[model samples]
Target: MNQSDEVEITLQVCDPKIIAGLNKFIVYTIKGMDKNGQFDIQRRFSDFKTIRSFLLTKWPGCYIPPVPPRKAFGNLEQQFIDERRLMLEDFLKKIATLKYLWYSEEFQVFLKTPGEIEKALLSVPKITNEEIINKYQDAFSDLSGREINREIIQKINDFKAYIQKISPMVQNFKQIAKNIAEAKSSFQASLIHFITVFIPEYENNVLLEYVEQKERLIFANLIQNEDAQGLINQYCDLLKEPKFQELYQEVRKEGKQLKAFLETFAEREKYESQKANAESRQKELQLELQEVLAGKTTIRTLFSKGKKEDHITKLQQQIADVGKEIESYQFICDILTVLVGYVEIDKFKMEKQFQYYNMIKNIISYEINLSKIAEEFWSKVLKSENMQQQQ
Candidate 1:
């Protein structure tokens, strides 16, 4: 093909190892195929084939075939090849950038210098060496920073000295600066390790024993205090005193009398109130009873004459209602009598005990009989009434 017909395709090599090795291979292929000190286009194609084969073997799923001579690759295959080429170019560019950054003069100097520890200390004026030591002490009082061991500290100090010596040589002290950074990091880490691993082992048992002893001492001192002794003595003295004994007896007697008076007063008040209400109710009931007993005042007379059946039904209902009212009044009166008798027995200070007791029993018996009479009266009134015929 003519030079114009030949497409110049740039192959971007990604991995440093791969780039180095492939570049060598390409150079060797170019040399081997050169004829009469001239570039051979066919030999370049052969190099492409060999490289393609190697890449396909390494990454089986990757690698697209070259377009056929008469037909260009389809849009999809062209896009895929474009994307792969872009990715490989990006990878190579990143490697070149990293190499430039790694070998820069500033980075080389940074690796060499003993960073100004004094400047850092001055910037943070509040954090002194004493403060750092105190912090370690507070965290782990038993295992001192010395637990990091003399050899480790000596090595760290030596690294610091070496960094300082090489600090003036800006280009040549990269390794020293790196060593100093690493040593500082190690020292800090060892301090933490000492506190975590060694301090607890040293102090755990001693702290427990010390705490127990302190507690015992505190308790012993408390028991020996004058206030504690005085409290005990006061309690004993109160138990033994004659005045206390007399006062206790008097209080007991007063309490018993007060309780008895309260109970008696409550009973009398209850009975008096009930008796007054019952008497008032009885007067009202007596008036009703008189009205009922007067044969002229029958239920038929109370309601105006209407339809005969309606009138009769109303009369019967009135009779039943009046009978229930009389029974309720009787029940209330009986309850009042029993309560009054109980109060009389309880209130009469001079009454014979047996007489008071007998009065209560009689009152209760009277109440029972009164109840029976009321029930019988009600039953008779209800039974005699021809209620169904009235309705």
Candidate 2:
């Protein structure tokens, strides 16, 4: 164990400050301590993203968790800055748990450095089969360090495709619940405005105005919706965990291992892009060699064939080498993905559904509850008025 390695670490993100420059940006205060002692450093979102890129390159197919998605707009707002701060803080803490990542010299530098750490970290070297096994011997217990191959890569591809297909629909169901809550608030607002303001102005009867005022107060209290709109909207806002909150709590939540496993796709995408470029370059070299060979048999053209032929052969070999690396990396990725499918993510009940219909049921039940509250309020108000008239 290296003396510099962080066996114990504590982290907190704070002091989100927005920099007003030619281009606006935000930075966070990351306070952390390990064996190396405590340090406070300021880092930007792009800096965190850069570290992710570095990790992906060095440890392809490793389970690197994601930070929050970058937002070009609305990022300067204090709320967004705080949310991002929490996410970045979470990302760093996860990395700290993995000795392969957190204890590395590169990662140590990244934590203390404020800006781009690209020059500080080693450039990613070409990967070897042995290196893959060495990095993962302890990373995932489920991997078992078994042999991996191209066929498993195909399995990973197919599995990821299926997940991607279902992702939108799962997200849409949650969004719909949010939308329903929003619509309830909108309707609640419109009804209150009609009863309190517009109707009171036109009706012009003292008794009617007095009754409407009470009605307005009731509806206003219904949400206190005037102050703010949160997840659980509408008259049900009175409930601790109303329909929306119930649905939010009930639905699917991703486990850390599953989240980590899914993020490897970004690493895979890089190799896919590299292979595509190599293949394209090979084609271009072949065409150039042909043109050189096709020229009239002159001294200059004839002599060029040897060089052109060698270049084409070299290009072809380069493409094949890239293909092999892609295969090896995909094998690693497959092992990680399977860990999630078979055992890793089961720790979180990753198989749960989105609870769409359940959300609808909650909404309907909330409406029923609202009806009861409205009746109770009206009944009490009228009883008080009748007692006043009898007196």
Candidate 3:
């Protein structure tokens, strides 16, 4: 079926539970509906793995989301089961969104009647480990002999390595996000405290200090915007010091770097998506090529047997083109990996620099405290003077 099929699918992952009908095996009940029909399928985690392997083999072009790792012994944990259910739901949603796979017979069978799959699995003969190894040894030897499979294997390893490297960095990024959030909260709170609490109390001394420095400087109403502006200017001058200036420049530099990193990251994601599309198209082309060669479609009669070769040739060309596109995306992704690594390093350094330079905020804090003390001192002095005058 094509993209025009009026198809829609929705799935909900239920909490894991054991049931009597299912032989007490802990399984997830997935409730879903589509234009074709609705279904409630009880599936064990192992069932998902089996079907996923089939999908990867038969529909390599589809973007299959990763599933949660299997737990042999700890599968009974409620929290782990919940997380796995969420991930499984996500995977199903991705499969549903792939229009090409929506009408796939295997996928439909999987969603509509899972009991059929169970029966098929039951019919399959089990082999001993020795027999399995002996039977697959030749296949493994043949696979190792093929350059293409070797390259694919290498790419898979590289992908896994990249994920391993980035996993900790991604976790660390959560802390960075939290740190920035707290910093912002602190900044906002400081503004509120300065305006609401510190201003009326400390403004007299902090603002009047300049009056002592500049002789004959007339102070406007003590609590006016004029005093606040003077204090702001004084604070600005302190920040203009060379040490603070350098720190400010560093922050700006880091900000620009972050902008660049974000732009490159967006490009990387775009190309990655494009690669997925191209790979899907490649699979289509390959399938078409197979059909033409096998004379399984109208191309054999319409194009004539002799000209049928031309269709196969054209399909092969399209497949090659998509393959090249996939390669280009892979190269771009590799470069992006390096760039992201650098960005992560830069981010760590930037966080440290920000924490160090944030000490500059203490200047205003110190001014506020000193002004509070001075205001208290003057209040005492005026009270004593008034008492003496009354006497």
Candidate 4:
């Protein structure tokens, strides 16, 4: 949160517990530290979803990190749950880098709140869309405080179309990764099934232990591959449901409101007569007040000189009230314009860089792990052959 602050988060412990007859869930042991010191918290998958939902609602214009997709318990529940934990850690670590979000009340509740966070998150003050705009501007005034101009609005419009175009491509890639992961899982299952049948069939079983060791290494490769690719898919989901799109919608919504607001000013049928009458009366009062100050109107104009003065005072109040009303309308226009045209869409551009960087890193690490698995498997195979020849 500050220059001296350090943060670390990892979700390595997931204890699967069953409750109420077949309703099973994963409870993750989230451990982390901050400038305050190290702390540990336990949260469920629902809890992760809860925190993400809170952030999404409260910070419409900012990036709210993605959570793993909700899926029913399957044969690969443990592996999937483990993969989800890793992804959740990535989510938190990404959030920690953004200072505004790191110190956000909702996130702080998630990181340090003593008990269940959902209720506490409710206690976190609700911010309106206008307020959200102000909050982001306060945080990134140098970058995003400018009024939304027609040029930037057009750029955002282009970006909206671009995201729509790219989202399906990302979704298709996620599907492919998912298919590969599932196929590997099935392959691992077949290998386990074969090992059970094959190992006991050997009477001497001289090759038994070596086969088992290779099996374990092969299993590790498949599991780790699934783990890594699972994250890639999660990242794809993030790209599909991006914060830029949400912020764009916020701007568009405000633009629509502004349009309707201007329409109110131009509604000749409904407001034109009233506006004309108010303007005419204001002019009349101004002229009359000027004449009163100049002593051009009679003191007996309103039964007494004091009543005549009171009339002048009332005219002054009416003009002031009209001016205040005009200022209020202008203020609303200013706020709306600032939101609809503010900020470059570079937030997502930067996020794309981050998402791709980390996604590629996971991919490279997964490949390296596969190489190690291969090396270990081959070494075991050759050593087993040597032992058999020596015997």
Candidate 5:
């Protein structure tokens, strides 16, 4: 038969009790076969020949012995059933492991659900027993969602314990990292300031003046660069002083600001980019409004032929369409304005008293406030009659 026409056969023994019985029978058959005899033709032949020779020499007229049964004669069907049962058990164990692993939080978040697993399984043409085992092994090592979750909880507990046990030490380390970072920043700032201000004032004597009047007002202003080498030197000197050292020690007792500082620094770039985009969008909206107003100026020419009903209807439809467009733009603009703290609403041609105008403002305000932590700004804007009366 052609490969396509060939029928695929599979056994579907569903009863758990029957499966258990088959497994037991197979195990017993295997054990019995093992105990029956070793399958070594060479050894058997040697023993048989030696016995025959001895019998012939010791007592004339000895008969030859018959051959033993082959290993397959023990219990072939039972062995087959046992092997199948073992294979099925292994398969089930692997699937169970996968299920447990997939349910784990980490894995679940990535895989989403059991349906994903089913989909993946269905995508393949056919999965062999060996392939399934191999996949299970491969997937198990990385299936750390449960372990990761447990570790996360344990880590939180450990962190809390650590805080309780050596909070002072932890604080000290934090302060040290913070101090180092701050010192580095201050040193840089001081260098800039020195180059910009003090260096010019003192000229050749700048370094000398800085060192001599380290505690002076002018030097303090110059050394605000937290990363300046000169500032770091001054900090070390301050550490030598009893009063300053005591203050430094007390500050060290406070928790470090390293995490806070690093987090802020990391977000700075994203915040700046968002701010720039908001500003650009605001400008674009203003230009668009100018264009709309300029276009509205031409509306008077179109209406120069007395207010005909048809003309009025067309104008009204056009106005409505423009109003809808304005509403959409305003929605976007409002969000930008709220994020950036200002929006230029005068760009659109819709009158302040227009219903659409109020609708746009209200919708924008609602959406912006929904996203914001504080709604005071949005609330005040919505409360104004200027937007309401315009509609």
Candidate 6:
């Protein structure tokens, strides 16, 4: 391996800090390291966008991996910042592995002195839409020969056929990830509602009242129980107060909000991880196809009394295996959807039925407590009377 091959580039995204300017924005310090040295560069998401554009212009037809979405809202959250940081790191790593890209003067300069990025960017004019159209049009005219066109067309068609097999699988995987994430969100919300709202309501309206009734009946026959009765009345009055109800509602709302936010944040992390793997594989296949079309890589020929036929057979088997794996994933996703639906239904029913049972239990428990206290008081009175008669 040459010196260039020995050069290993690594990128680390540091914690985000607020950029000082007229309009303060959050930016992260991307720490880049190679055999040469280490450099710390602070950049916003737009900087990454510019870099992607530069790459596309420099390496046309080469697959560029997807970047973090340029979201206009909620970008300030620490979790959002962290997720984007990871994506940016991945983007840098991919670029570093490309020989022509990593060693470019522009890339080296950007890494060494980020302050001069604007100057570097200005040197490469954005490709005009008209120019792009004209280039393709001229290319087609150059390939006007029927034989040449037929061969190129056949190669393109074969490439498309192979890609078509992988495309659906990639699409299905993304869809499954999306549905699972949404379902997880819904489940989290339902669970929070059950814990914060339903459970609290049951405790306050049912348990408190049941316990209060027992105390009330026990003090009914005691002449000197004014202090105890007053304490019980105070507790009942507090339960009825609007301020107390408002506070309870606020707490419940906050609990749900916090739980939902935390859970959704975690879901985003998991979704991004799954998405990165899919996108990487998709881009790999796309780059391979592009290389084949561009004549950079030799195309496999069939039945030529060599390893070409074996190579093609191996590729065909891999595609078949991927198709089977996709089918299994689809089945699993379907089952998960059904299960999530069932859980939602059960959760709703539980909420409704629990409230009813809660009310019934409160009433039954209060009556039972009162009856026990009354029975004890009467038993004492009867015993005193019987003792007087015997004396």
**Model number with the top lDDT:** 2
Name the weakest run of 10 consecutive residues (lDDT summed) in model 1.
27-36
Q: What is the TM-score of each candidate against the true structure?
A: 0.17, 0.55, 0.34, 0.53, 0.16, 0.41
Comparison by TM-score, 1 against 2, better one: 2
Q: Summarize candidate 6's per-residue lDDT along 1-391 as a digit string, tens digits.
A: 4675577777787778877788667777878778668888887777777776565554333334445667788887786677678767766876676545666545666666666466767765565434433442343243232342354434434533544455555455545545654564465456445533665466556655865642332223222356434443433333332232222222232233233223322332333354455455555555544554454544343224555445445545555554544444333232222322323223433543664466457646654654564455445534543234545
- What is the per-residue lDDT of model 1 for residues 176-281, given as tens digits with 9 covering 90 to 100? 4445545644654564344334444444445436645433332233324575444433433332322222222222322332333334334334434654665566
Clashes of each: 2, 0, 0, 2, 26, 0
The residue-level lDDT of candidate 1 at 357 comes to 56
Residue 264 shift from truth in candidate 3, angstroms? 23
**What is candidate 4's lDDT per residue for 68-135, written digit by digit as tens?**
56676572466556656666676677677765777778887887786777787878887743465467
Between the candidate structures 1 and 6, which one is better when assessed by TM-score? Answer: 6
Ten-residue stretch with the least lDDT total in model 2: 248-257
Clashes of 6: 0
- The lDDT values for all models are 0.35, 0.60, 0.54, 0.54, 0.35, 0.50
How many clashing pairs in candidate 2?
0
Tens digit of lDDT per residue, candidate 2, span 1-391?
A: 5566535788898998888999988888889788777878887888787888777666775656666776778888885687578678867887877767886656777887655666656544555655754666555554575555665556667666866776666566656766765565577667556644654455445444665654433323333344322322433344433345445323322332334456666565665565566556656555654665565344444565566567556656765675666566555555555554444334323323324455567778776787776565445434544334545
Candidate with the larger TM-score of 3 and 5: 3
**Which ranges in model 3 have alpha carbons more than 4 Å from their true place?**
1-4, 19-24, 116-391
lDDT rank, highest first?
A: 2, 3, 4, 6, 1, 5
What does the lDDT read for residue 383 in candidate 1? 42
The 10-residue segment with the lowest total lDDT in model 3: 214-223
Sliding window of 10 residues with minimal summed lDDT for model 4:
261-270
List candidate 2 stretches off by more than 4 Å: 1-9, 96-99, 122-130, 138-142, 145-158, 174-178, 181-391
| Rank by TM-score (best first) | 2, 4, 6, 3, 1, 5
